[model samples]
Each structure stands twice: as C-alpha cells, then as structure tokens.
Target chain A: MTVTLIGGEMLHWSDRPATPALPPVGEITGRTLVAGPHPHDLIASLPAERTTVLLRGLPDAEAVAGLGVTVWAGSLDKVAATPAFDTIVALDGLDRLCSAEAETLDGWDERLAHLLTLLRPGGRLLLRVENLFGVHRLIALPEALGDSEWLVADDRDPHRPAGLAALRERLAVVREYAAYGDALLSREVLADAELSGFVSATIAGALATTGEVLADPAALATRALRHGLALELAPAWVVVTGGAADTPDAVVGAKAVAAADPPRGRTLEDELIAAAQRRDLPAMRALLTAWQKSPAAGVPAAQVIAGSASPAASDLTPLAPAGDPLVALSHFAAAAIRGDIAHLWPAPADEAELTALIAGMTGREVEPADVPPLPSRPAPGAVRELTAERDRLARELAEARAKHEFYEQQIRGRDAELKRVRQINAVLSATAPGKAVLGGLKAGRRAVRAVVKRGRA
Target chain B: MECGVHHANHYYGHSAVLARYCGLDDEAPRIQGYLQHGWNIGDGLAPDHEFVPGVPKFLWSERVRRRAWSLGRRDVYVVGAPWAYLLALEPAAPAEREGTIWYPFHGWEGQHVLGSHDNLIAEIKATEPGPVTVCLYWQEYRDKAVRATYEKAGFRVICHGYRGGWWKDLDPGFLYRQLAELRRHSRVASNRLCSAVFYGTLAGCAPAVYGDPMQLENEKSAFGGQARILREWSDMIGAEVDLETARRVAVAELGADRLLPPAELRRLFGWPAPRSTAAIELTGVLTS
Candidate 1:
C-alpha cells in the first residue's frame, strides 16, 4: 500500500523539520515503523521494502510515499494494532501526533505509553520530550498563541514526568542526550552527564545565534552552567530505549553523531564574573590581560573558555561578526553590570565606567565613543519593570511637587522675616539714639575704609 | 517654572553658577530640583526649611545622599556643589596669594551663635603665619563690636556679601566674590568643619579646622553635629592638615569629581537643549 488513512488525517499541514531528534540513519535495520513525520533523506536511507512510515498529516504522508516506503496517514490511535514493529521513532514528541478532528489521548504520559506498546520486543523507540523549564522557554517573551495550538496541551499532567530524573525513570532508559536550541532542529546535543561549562557555553552560543529574543539566552545558559543545572534546564531530551544498536554520546551534525572528548574549564565570562563578585582586582586584571592577549579576543567573552593555560574560543561559531577587542570587553563589562552576575564595581559604576575600568585593567585606554552601546533588548518581565519604573517616577514627581510647596511655604516664612527685619530697621532709624548709632556705624566704616585706602596708597 | 525655589537655590548665586556651567546665558532656568545650598552634615537642605515631599534634593555628595536615604528621604540626586562648578568655570591662575582667611562659625537666619571672638582671634594669631583676614558672616560683620574686635586686633575684616534671603537680594556673584577672596588667601581656616573650610580646601587653599566650634542657639544635633563631624573628618582637622588628604576629602564632600558634562547637567535640570544655528534661524524667522 502506498498510503493508508483509516481516519482523522489532517490535510496540507506538515510538522516542521520533517524529523527532529533523529538517531543516526545507520541504526535503522530490518522491518521498521516510523510513526511520525521524518526527514526525506532518513526515509530514503531506510530499508523501504520492509519499513513503514505513519504520519497524521496527509501531505507529509504523501511526501514520504515517493521514498518507496509504505505510509499510514491518520492519528496515532488509528494506526493498525495487529503487527508490531521492529523499530519505532516518535522524536517529534507525543503532542503533535494527534489530529484536532479525532479523540486524542488526554495526557503526555498516556500517549507515550501507547507508543511504547507498538514496539516489538528488543526493538528501539527514540522519543523527544521538551523540558518546560528549559533556557529557550525561560528567556522567551510571552507570545500570542499560534494557529496550530488550537488545543493547548495542559502540560500539568501529574502522570507525566517533570524533570530529567522523572523522565529517565518513566522511560527506564540510561541513554539520554540533552538537546539545545529549538527542539525541531537542535543546534547541539550532548550526553547529560558530560555537560560542562564549555559545552554549555557552546550550547548557549547556538541558542542565541538566531532571532530577536526577550533577553540574551547566552547569559541565562552560562548562569545555568554555573549553578550546575545545565542538563536539567536543557531545551529537550532525546532518549533511546530498547535495541542493542549502540548510541552516540553526542550528536554534532546529521553524520558526525559520535561522542567527542568533554571540554573542561569555565568560560571567561564566568571567571570574570566570579572574580568581580569576590572583589579580587588582581585576579580580574590578570584574567582580562590573558583574555585580551589571546587570539580569540575578538570573540564574545561568553563564547570563550577560560582554561588554566590560556583563554580559548569554544567550537560554536559566533553568530555576529568579530568585533573590536575593546568592544568585546565592553560587552562583557555590560553583561557583568546588567546580568545576574553580582555588581562589579565597589563604587557605583554604570556600563561606560565599568567598560573603561575593564579596559584599563588590560592596560588599554578606551574612549567613550569606542565603547559599544548596550543592547536594548525587550526585557523578559516587561510589565513588572514598567510598573517599577512607574512607581519610581511617581515618587520623583511627588517629591518634586512637595519641594514646590515647601519652597512656597519657605517664601511665605521668609517674607514674614523680611517684614519683621524691615519693621525693626524702621524703628531703629525712627529713634534719636538709633539714628546716632547708625550714623556713627557709617562714620566708623568710612574711617576704617579710609585708613585701609591710605595704607594701600 | 520658577528658576529659584526655597530662596536657597539663589543663596550664594548657586543657580547662577550651575546655569553658567550648563552653557546657558545669565538668565538661569529654574533648576528642576532643590539645589543643595551649603555643605551641611544634614541632607544638604536647611533643617528648618520644611522639605516639600517628593521634590528631589539635589545633594552635593554621595555621603549626603546615603544619609538622606537613611533619614527616609527619596528622589535625592547628587549633582556636586555649585561652588565646585564655579571653580571649574573660573580656575585661579598662579598668583602671589597672602594671609589666612579665618571664618568664625556663624548661624543661619533662625539662630544666633554664642562664642568668644577674642579667644578665636588669639587662636588665629597664634596659628596663622601671615596677616589674617577675618571673613565674618554678614550678620557678624554688621555687629560693631564683632567688626571692631577683628579690626582693632590689626586684622583686615571683610564680608562676602549677603547669602540672599527669600530670593530678593540674591547676589548672583556671591560665590564668585568668595572664590576670588579664597584664592587670594594662602590658607583657609574656620572654627568649625563647615562649608567654608571645604570650599577653601577645594579652591586650592591650605585648609584648617580649629578653635571652639561656637554653639548655635538651640543647635539641633539631628545630623551628628560638630562632635560627629570632628570625629568623622579627623583627617581634615588641625592647623596644618595634609593638603593631599584634605583635597581628597573636599573632592568627595563637594562631589567635584562627579561633575556632569554641560549637556548632561542641562538634561538633568530640564533646561533647554543647545540650539542649533538652523533651528535658531527657523525660530527667528517664525517670530519675525
């Protein structure tokens, strides 16, 4: 059969990237049933004679039919229950597998349990699960609901696993790779246990490489790395459960899906922040000097790894063009001041002063014009920030008005004082002895001035 | 907007100096906030003057801002002292300065000071190496007895005009006259560690704080007072204090180093932006 739709198949629409969290194509063997929209290249590489692809969207199923594979077009519940598959892939997660026209599973866990049942004994099931608390979601500005989100999945299902620990326990799989950036096209994937500052920095760079974000994701990811929560806060989880086929510790590209040596040491951004927090000036100066002298000085501090030997740029290519060394330093200085990193200067210093101070530590004098402008990104908590600013301005305005009233009251009081002083002066000038005393005082002043003037001459 | 508020903004022509520094013509704009008139231990504003709520207290120093914050005052911004701004505008060239300018502590309008003038005069004669010019406050200078005491002691006595009251005799050149007199003196001394002492220190005069800190009538010790000032500023006290240390103290107290650029100060004070030639011509054409 070319393509079969028993019931509830959506038309025209196809889930993006075709395939996400795909295990290496070489892992596909014998009879297989891929129950989701997968990449065309992946479908073509599979042993199509025995392999079967099931997709909920009619267009996606039709697109895959040309790859010489049997296709099923319908919701997951409509898939034939008779013959179990030797391999199953649902890497798009369970949420998108159902059509709005059909009665769908109530929870993620229930849907995941249903998919696992379709797998034959010893057959592998590759699944991707998104982490709600991931860095990508954490920094995202509140967006309006998309058209596809008609039935917003209530992710608060108590039966569904919440974190990595719960997810592993539910899946009963020891092999899990943390996915970064978009779940549809993960920029980088690494073994959960092997996560380090360098890996997190690379992942952070990748996540921030595209789009106008609410705030810089690189700072958040670097912070997560510092707090030892990188793996827990990974964007998505790709786990392989079942089968004896070996899995790679990391995924680099479509082909280089193999474990690489784990990177060591914290990023220069992390080290600089730490030094600044401790108020260790010498340490900060040394670190700045070494970093500025390095070949990767033009790279952003967050993208460079700070090793004991010297600073080195991480493998992740910077999305922005290489800037002046001073500008890069200025960006780090801005990050230190604006980011969650503790305030750098003991004396209150704004971004420009901090930038100049950082440059000075490296024995380079930077002009104000040379310093990069601070990026004016939309704040993550716009309403709260606006409310705070409103309250501050209100206090300032109230203070200004109060001062105005106080000045008026002062003027009134001083006017009364002036009237009193004038009345006293009038009384003094009106009396005989007062006139004599005033006349004598004037004469004395005249005599004193004459004496000084004669002496000067 | 009122160019001067609380009349103190006009005192010593502080607003005038700030306006000149802001590159504005003599017609100074009303400063957007309450400008700190004197270098006081209090929140920069005179304690007797009722502070209007929420009106910004444009303080002289960070120390004052901190103190004001602790005392439940908000919207305080430190714009340095107007005296410092004046010094920046008219810097003194190298000149043969002579004598010590001694300022006997005087009270504000609300209080009369109590102290022996002869005892201070004796102390000044002993401490100062050259001719002493006893700079008396206008109140003291007006008193025949106080004036005669210094005049008879063979010391020149002078007053730096009135620190204008109620905005009526606002001597705009008050600080200007005081700066010139301070620069003429080899040293500046006051009985108490007061504004004059700090101003002299900043004006490149050797500073001294000695003698009795003459008590004010019912002087409220709301801001630690003279005893606290002595203890806190021990580095700035004595006949021959370290000039470098004294200068540093004066700079911090006056916020001399924190003076904003002309444009920034103009912006902060809500003054008009610098007019471009084209814009000025356009305005002229419209008016004509």
Candidate 2:
C-alpha cells in the first residue's frame, strides 16, 4: 500500500479526533473508496487490496496507508473524474471531504452529488447526515463558531435533507437507521419503524451515557419515541443507497456491533405518560397498580417494559433498587414534567407533588424522605443550570425588594395609626365626659397603689 | 406541632381546622406550607405579606393555584379552605334555619373601609325577603356607632370573635363559631364577593353578593382589585343567585372536592400520623 499525495491537502488538521460509528465492516465490500478520515482500526479491518481511502489531511492519509490500504491525500475535487470504486463510504457526511486548500464546494447538494458521481455502476454509498432539528440541537445552547463550521450552509441549504423522511426521499435510501449519541460517536442505531419498548429502553440507556447536555437527552429521546417522532428527532441518520440487505434491525454500540433482539412493547413510562396526557385516571391507576405490584417496582419506569399484565426490567443486570419506591415513580414523573405532558392532577402539581400523587394512587403516602433528590441530579449543562439559578436568584431578589417595600409601608401605616390614635386621645381629653372617665381611671390606679402599699406594710 | 411562622396561618383559626381534619384533634400543627388565609383576587396571598422562597403555598382552589403559579410560585398545592374542612368535621343538624346572614366587607388594622354602611344596610333590607343578621369584623363590631347603624336598620348584628394577632390569643373555635352561625341561617349575602359567601354556599345556604362593596383606605389595585372580582365572578354577584350554580361555583372556588384523606393531609402537613395508622402503614410497607 502506498500513500499518494495529490497536493492541496491540509498538512496538519484531521477531520474528527474521535472514532465515528460506522457501518458493520462486513457490509463494506468490493473495491471501496473510504471518503474522508475514518478510524485506523476500521481501515485495517477492511480488505487492504481493494480498499482505497481518500483523506483531506496528509497526516491522516499516511496513518491509513500504514494500515495496508491505498491512501489518496488531497481535496475531494482532486480525486480522478473517472467513476472507479464499487463502494463510497462517506460516513462523516460530504462536508469534511472538501479542503479549504482546494476548490471549496460549500453547497451540501453539490458535495453530495460529487460523492454520488464517484461511485461506479452497481456501487453502494454509505452516508451519515446530521439532523438540524435533532434532540441534541433542540436542547443545545448557542455555541461559538468552531473550526468545522467554516461554511455554515447546512442551515440555509434548501436541497439538503432536513429529517429522516426527507433524507430518505433525497437519497433514494434502501435502508435507513436513526442514530443516537454525539455526532462523532453514534452510540445506538435502530431501524426507522422499530421504536419498540426494547428499542426505546436501549435508546434511553444509550442516551444516559451522554456526557454534557443542556437538558436530559434520555428524557427528550424517550419523549420523542413516545410522540412517534423519534425518527425525525434522532441526533443523526445513517442511510445506504442500494437494495436492502439482511442486516440487523438494530445495531448497538459502534465497536461491539451487537444486533439487538426484536423490539418488545411500550415502556411503562411511555404508557403511564400517555395515559396521563389523556387524563385517563382509571388507566393510570391500573398501570400504577400493576407496576407497583411487580418485581421491577424498584426499577425506574423508563427502564421497564410494560407487558400486558406485568412489568419487567429491561436491563436484566441486577441493579440496586432505587431506595424509596416513590423515587422509582419519580423517574417517570420527572420525565412527564420535562416532556410537558398535561398534568394529571385536578390542581397544578410540581414534580415532587406529582410523584407523591402517583404514590398515593398506589396507597402509599410520600414522606419528605420519599421525595426525589432532583436538584442533586447531574447538572443538565452549565448554561441551563446557570440560567435556572439566575432566574431563581432574580425571583428571590424581586421578592426581597417587594418585602422591603411592604415592610416600609407597614412601618408608615403603623406611624400613621399611632398619630391618629394620639389625635383621637387629644380630642377625647377636650370633652367633659372623657375628663370624668380619665379622672375616675386615675383615682382607681391611685387606690390600687395605696392598697398594695398597705398590704405590703 | 405548634403553629408559628407567618401567624396568618392561624388567622380565623384556619390551621386548627386543618389540624382537626388531619385527625390532630384540637392540636394545631405548624402547617408545612403557607396556608392561604383569606379569599382574595390576588394569588391566594395578601400582596402585602412577604413570603419565603421555596416554601410551599397551600392554596384553596385550582384557580388560585394557577394564579399563584403565574405569579412565579412553583411549590403551590391546593388543599381546600379551612372552612371546608370545618364543615366536614361538623355536619349541620337539621333545624329550622331562618333569615339571611349578611357579611359586609371590612378592613383590617391600619385600614378603614370608606363607603356608606347605612347604604349597604338599606340594600340588604330591600333585597332580603326575610330577617337579616349582619356579621361584622371585630374592629367594626367594637364601634358602638357602627353597630347601632345596622341595628337601626332592623338587622340583627353579630361578630364572629377576634381572628388572632401575631402569636397571641389564636382562638381555635373561630371557624367553628362562624360555621355554626352560617348553618343557622337559610341564606348568605355579602356586600362584596368574599370568602364568607363561598363558605355559606358550600354549607348549604343560598348565596348572593350585591350592593356597595366598601373600599379600603389606600386600596391598591395591584391584582385588579374589586373591578376584576366583579368582572370575573359576575355570576355570583346578584341579589338572588341560582342555588345549583352558586353551589357549583362554591365547590370549585373552595376546592371542596380536593380534600385529602386524613393520612395524606398529615403527610402533606409534615405532622406525625396517629400511632395506630402509622403501625398499619409500616406493616403495609414491610409486607410490600
């Protein structure tokens, strides 16, 4: 294997530092041109003789060449105009394939078309497109410009696929998988129509491992699944151009590549929230009764599968029971609040009160200890946490100011009352009847004092 | 448990009623939340009264709870009014209840009502078909001149005792006496749409709110004062209200249906459960 330099490639910069989740290496077959930078291990796994890795960075190209695969180091436009490769793998999407050193193709549509043209007749194209309206972006705080955002056309590009459905239509996709996790590290991939209880539990589990997010990604992801918009709200999408293959419906974790079993029914949390949104008290009570009576009562409702008559914890691994059963119920309660589900209470209830009410439905009264320690939860993100704190402080400040003003008014009112009472006393002393009463009161006090003195003597 | 913190919780012996409803008998527990003391157009709280942040506000109804939430209160719960709890504790005996019990809007310390009490008395005489008994706040009842005005109008005048001050002389029987007096009357009427009207409606009395709504000195319209009350509650403001509609509005405004069971109320108030029930709950917990 030789590293060929076609000039115009970046000498220092690599596309992504972390390894991205890719299609199963078993799927990358025939003479393949791996577009953009991929992990070294993934390049080594591919058939070296047939694989031709194209990288925009010289250092990345050299590293791939060391893995016993042909490496073409240059901008994507410099690659031969002839359609040669039987497969084109641009799992990083078409954005990073172009280099600033060469003719920069900023339009997503133009870059995508170029990648498609590079593929030979009867070839396959594996692509990954980041979703603009994804859950990750929805909860993301405003970020400063990064090196990768040199040409921000994704937001303005009309032809660029915006969602899973649009992407399928745009690419004529044979198979599509909803990808969840950080963009570079797609943790879980599931088929578009396979958001079953098992798939959701898997999605939630995968999302929990997300490092720093504005809000709980797990809650938002599960809500998306419950609302039947998981495919649209997925953080990213992986699409393949060609006829469908017999690949697994769900691929969990990029490295291990374990095919998850077929999906089960809806999660307990999902069903309970749906019932709550509809204000179906009887259904909610029944679901709460069933869950509380089950062996998985101590498990978080989001992690349990709501079977017909019973609930089973999705993760079979023996985990420590959430100490208070109310704590277990609070998981779904918090999710419901975060999901903006209509409150079930006839009156407005916060998360703690709602959890207590849920416990009450199961004949349990929640003590102060039973309330979930929600504030101690991993801070959603620095921005949101700070924003909430600032809002709280602002409210407290406004309250304190109001209290100060109230106290001042109270003092003023008291002063006015005292002055009014003094004026009334002055007016009373000026009257004949008032003088007689005052004289009698003075005489009575003198008589009492003399009697007390006589008794002491 | 002793009632302290924001002594208004003990106003009209409100905490005592809630405590009794929670099975505390005569012992008034320190309510874990700020119990809404009076019905107001504001967020269930007296705008002049300061609140501690994060402390729960136990309100009377869903409407007030929503209003309180809009006012930036997050930890608000609807526990119904103390008067409702009192009625639950003391079911009225069947008796020949006669006359209309009238409540004239009154002012508290540092404020005096500025309207014609004689005019209100005349309105009451004209509207009420039967005998009328006017219930006055302690301050007005203490004034012989004010008392004689209502008495001169041929209406029986009475006062429901002092509503306590600071931590001093909190009469636990305040609501009990008010409820008893209300139940003895066939109808309840008020010059303004006040808490007494709602309480009386819930206590099986036909309710009416009309005539001069006396204004307080320096009355602030911070929460859309009397105008908002008249606009929002126009159905309740008539010389003769439909009994069914009055009762329905009373139930919603007072949250009669939102009353908690004794055990749950105890938990919410952070009061200890009675030993027997505690042991039963403990057994249930361990068995489960």
Candidate 3:
C-alpha cells in the first residue's frame, strides 16, 4: 500500500487517494519462480506467462494451478536448475530451507547464500517474513496465540522472524521497509484508504477491523521519507537485496541500509552525501571528481572536497596503488584525523590539492592546523631483538605442551587397555572353560613332578 | 520460515482441519509471537521455536500446559487444541462407519516410532482385528513396503497418492473426500498420532492408546512423546477416546470461551494475503 499525504502534518485519509504505491508482484516478464505456498500475494502479483510456482504441499496446488500459472508440485531443489531465475520471491514459507529443516538457526545465512547462487547475475531476491512483534500481538486473543511454549516463553528466534536484523545482515539488504505502518496508530496504508469508518470496514479488507483507526500525524511517513523507516514497528519487513558483487555500486555493504528513495531529481551534492553515509567510495569519488570540475564545487567547495575526495580509510584496492592520488588522499585523511598531515600529497608541495581533498572527505572547511605534522617514532633495534627471543621461547613451550598432550593421551589409552585386560581375566576365571583350563594345567604340573620322581628312583 | 512442523505427514492436514472446524481460513492461523508447533518437542523445536522469535504459549491439554510452565513460561493456558474443536461438531451415525482402521506409526523413515515398523505390522497381522483399513503417511506412501507390509498381512489399505506431503493442493472438495474416507472407520489405532485418529474419532470412532515409544526412548531417538504436548497426543493413539467428552471438556474445561474471533485473529496474525503493493514496482503487473 502506498500513501502520500498532502502538504500537512496530518493525513486526512483522503490526502493522496490513489492506490497505494506498493511493489506489484508477478509483474516481471522474465522466467521467475515463487517457491513455496500461495495466496502468497506475491505470486498473483506476478505475470503468469513468465512465472512458475513451486509449491511445497499439495493443499494449495489446485488453486495455484487454476490461476493458469505453470505449477510444479515438488521442491525447487528437486526440480529447478541453478542460476535459473531473474528474480526469486521467497515470501511466505522459509522453514523449507535446509537450515529450518535441520533446526539449525545458525545456518540461516548460509541457506540464503545458497539461494543467491540460484539467481542470474544481478538477480533480485526479495525476502518477506512476518515480524514477531507485529501490532496484532497486543490485540490478539489468547486462543489465537496458541497456548504453547512460544506464547509464554522466550520469543526471539531467528527462524520465526521476530525481526529482520539477521536477515538484513545476511542479504546485505539494499532496502528494508515494513509494509504496515505505525502499529500503535494504524493510519492509511495508501493514499486511497479512507480512515473514516476504516476500522468498521478494514485496512486491507482481510485483517479484522480494529474499529479504532489511530492517527499518528505523519510521524512514520516522515521517517520513511528520510530513509530511516522503522522496520521494528511495521507489521512485516520486505527486503530488496542484490547478491554480493565486487563493484562498489553493486555491493551492499554489511551495514548498508536502503534509505527511502528520495525524489528522482537529486542534486549531485545530495547524492554525494548519501554515498558518504553508505560508504560507497566509488560513488563518492565519482561525485567528488565531478563536483571538483563543476561551478557548485566552489560554493561550499571546501565541504564537498572534505566529504568525498580525501582518503578516509585504507580499504581501497587494485585501482589505487601506494602513491596514487586517491590512495595518497585517503592516507592523508587518516593522518589528518590523527592531527598529522605530512605527505598528504607527494613531497607535501600540493597544499591546495591537499586542502581540497580534506574538504571533500570530511565535508568540513580546511584549516592550517588541520594539517598537523607527523608524530615522531622511536628506535626499534633493541626492542625488536628482545621481542624475537621472547617469540622463540613461547613457540618452544607451545610445541612442548603439544608433545606432552600427545604422550598423555597415549598413556591414558594404555591404562584403559590394562584395566580392560584385568577385567577380562577376572571374567575368565568365573567361567567353566577358564576353570577347566586352570585345573588341567595344575594336574599336568603334578603329573610331571611324579614322573620326574619316578625317573630319579 | 519452514513452519517447523514435521512434514509429508498428517501435519499438513492440521491447519486444514483447524480451519475446517474453527471457521478459519484454510491457511494455518497466523498467530502472533512464535509458534512452537507443539511445545517441548524442543529438540527440533527449540532453545526456542526455531523459525520465530515468539514466546511459547499452549492451548492444549493440562499435561502440555504443565510442561510449558515447568519450562519457566507463565503464559500457559489450557485452552485446548484449536483443531480438537472438530470433535465438537456432530459426526455421522455408526451405520456410516465400517469396521476398525489401523494407522501405523511413522517416523522420518519409520525410524523412531519404533525400532522397526515391521514389528508392529507383524504383531497386528497376528491379532484379533486382522482385516483393518490402513491409513498411510505420505512418506510411507513412497515406501512400497509400508503399503506392502500391511497388504501382506491381509488388510485393506488406502494411502495418500500425492507427491507433495499432506497439505498442498488441498481444496474443499478434496477435504470433503478425505474426511468421508476417514469417517468410514468406527475404530482407529496407531503407535503415533496420525490425522486419521484425530478426524476419525471426531467422526465417531473409538481411539485407543497402547505403548508410547517417545516415552520409552531417549529425546534423540524420538519426537513422538518427547514434548509434553506430543506425549499427550501420542498417548491418545490407543486410549479410550471420549471424542464427545473431550470436545465438551475442551470447550468448558480448557477455557474455549477465550477463543479469539476472526477479527481479533486477523489483527494478531500474519496477513490473510500479502498486502504490499511494493512488489508491483519491483517487477511486473498481473492482469487478474
């Protein structure tokens, strides 16, 4: 559901009255697989010609098949080839993943990684699951809660999806947003929704009307607009993800969060600021270089240079060599943060260039004191020599401990064997076979003695 | 999430059964918090419910409620199983039912329900009600021996033919047919809790319990009686099933009055259908 309020703090229910601008499902023309069960709104949302639905159970297969979509009744692993789909919508049932089957929550991310392998290059993977702390929890009936351990005991299982934090981490989520907005004050889901008599009718026509439409006065909508959408508060989280790739733009960093999309028209400056927050070095660099050559670059030129051009971290590789301008610029930023600015450029001659780089990386003005002298270092010959001796002794001790452990194990094994042998001998004596053998040996010894005596006689 | 429920078995029918009896959607009730499936089945089911971040709350038998409480959960309720409500509904007359039905135990590979299922079938083959109707688990349907084991014993058998385990392409018509087939039996028996025992007794049969393997075996070897809830369910396999009394007790004794209305359920559970128009922008537009 999509809703855009008119120019006011309050959504009057009729503000933006068109259908909510939700992501339509089943719209893709390429081959796609909706792997799980249906009434997965995502399935019906997709175009039937290009999609094949793989259902886990047969319960919903007839209805899904009736929709004229090619329906497969087995598992995706049992049927489909890898790198198969342009997009895969794993919306409703995730428990079918091997990790869930094995009851191994730790393997959830690994399962996701494997799923990514099924995607064509740059294929979109949308993972949707219910939030554990959905608004309904506060208003649910005790019976619906299912009087089980889950309703009474601990509630934050990674598999049951109390929230999207783990999923976000695994997917390197480019964008994560809750579909339902403002739990406490249920507002319009889309502009077309009329809050007037909303609870009596319904929010989406499926959920029972609470009869109490909450008015939050744009608190959440504003947050969403700022790209700070609160995933925890929403009823469900939808993640738009791209697989891990080497390109800086393609890579969704481990901590990257998809902010709400800003207006289609972004000033280069705004884009630069966003790139900085995302730590998108390539975007920041490209924007910075462009700005350096543009007229606007000189207006707050110093701040632009500080925010983008400077070397903030030594993380760049392949493209930048040890003394490359960009590489040198990052080193300079690091040193500047530490109040040292020597060698920010080659031989420190390019003061103007250093200032511009500093301005871009930090998004602040360049000051003379911002370029502090490098700190002096102490001599290390004697210290290095002593450290070597210490390392040699520590290594020798570790080796000795390992050898001692091996012998200790061997001795313990031998002791166990001796104890078993003693037990076996005791058992042997108790048996008739053992007794007869002993008795026979004794008789032979006595008979031999008699024979010897006879020989003597 | 994988739903965490054991699959290719009667579990797939659980939601359909509940939905059929309780006026819910054919989909499982999207209850809030976490769903443990059945509580204390904790090996595959816990540290917590594997797929959700939810507190365990039980609405089943007294035995199950106690187990959840002992696990340090104070939210225990004896509201009874929602699916058990099917028993409250009137059943077909005795004339509608045939003779006895035998539902053999099923493990992943018929492993834990017994060291070997062959022993049970062999024992039944030598017993009084030799000509019993056998209900096959989906996995067993795949195993010819499972069907053959009963068939060789000279028993009549009916098995699931679908490749997908219990609940995929389930329509109302299919459900009606499945229920009709189950109702034909006046007596039901099994080593584990199968849907036939559940729907059968509700359809007017006596369910009896004998030995509970989960109780005798270690947690690693069994899921049958491993949890407080599963134990109660498995214990019902051969007990004198008072389907009517149990149904009444569930309503009165187990606090059925507290059962939430559909509106409350919709508010509390996951959406009946996916709600976000967000997908439309990502890809294509559907005509229908």
Native contacts present in candidate 1, fraction: 0.22
lDDT of 2 by residue, A1-457 (tens): 7788876688987777323554462277788888887767677778999888888888788777878888889888787676477888877777788887767566788888877788876678888788888887887767678886777746667888777667767777776767775222222343433335666776776664234567777767767776767778887777777655644455655532334443345677777877766644445656776677767778777667665334332222212354456777776666665655523342224557667766765656675455866644533453554455566457657655655665566579769988999999999997999999999999999999999999999
The models' CA-based lDDT, in order, is 0.70, 0.71, 0.42
lDDT string for model 1 (B202-229, tens) is: 8889999899888988877877888888
- Identify the superior model by DockQ, candidate 2 or candidate 3: 2
What's model 1's lDDT at B30?
Answer: 75
Q: Report model 2's TM-score to 2 decimal places.
A: 0.59
Against the native chain B, what TM-score does each candidate's chain B reach? 0.92, 0.92, 0.60
DockQ of each candidate, alpha-carbon based: 0.11, 0.08, 0.00
lDDT of 1 by residue, A82-137 (tens): 57777777666777777767676657887787777788877777777778878777
Order of quality (TM-score): 1, 2, 3
Candidate 2 CAPRI assessment class: incorrect
Report the Cα lDDT for candidate 2: 0.71
Which candidate number would show the highest DockQ if scored against the true structure? Answer: 1
* Displacement of the residue B34 alpha carbon in candidate 3, Å: 4.4
Worst 10 residues of 3 chain A by lDDT: A10-19
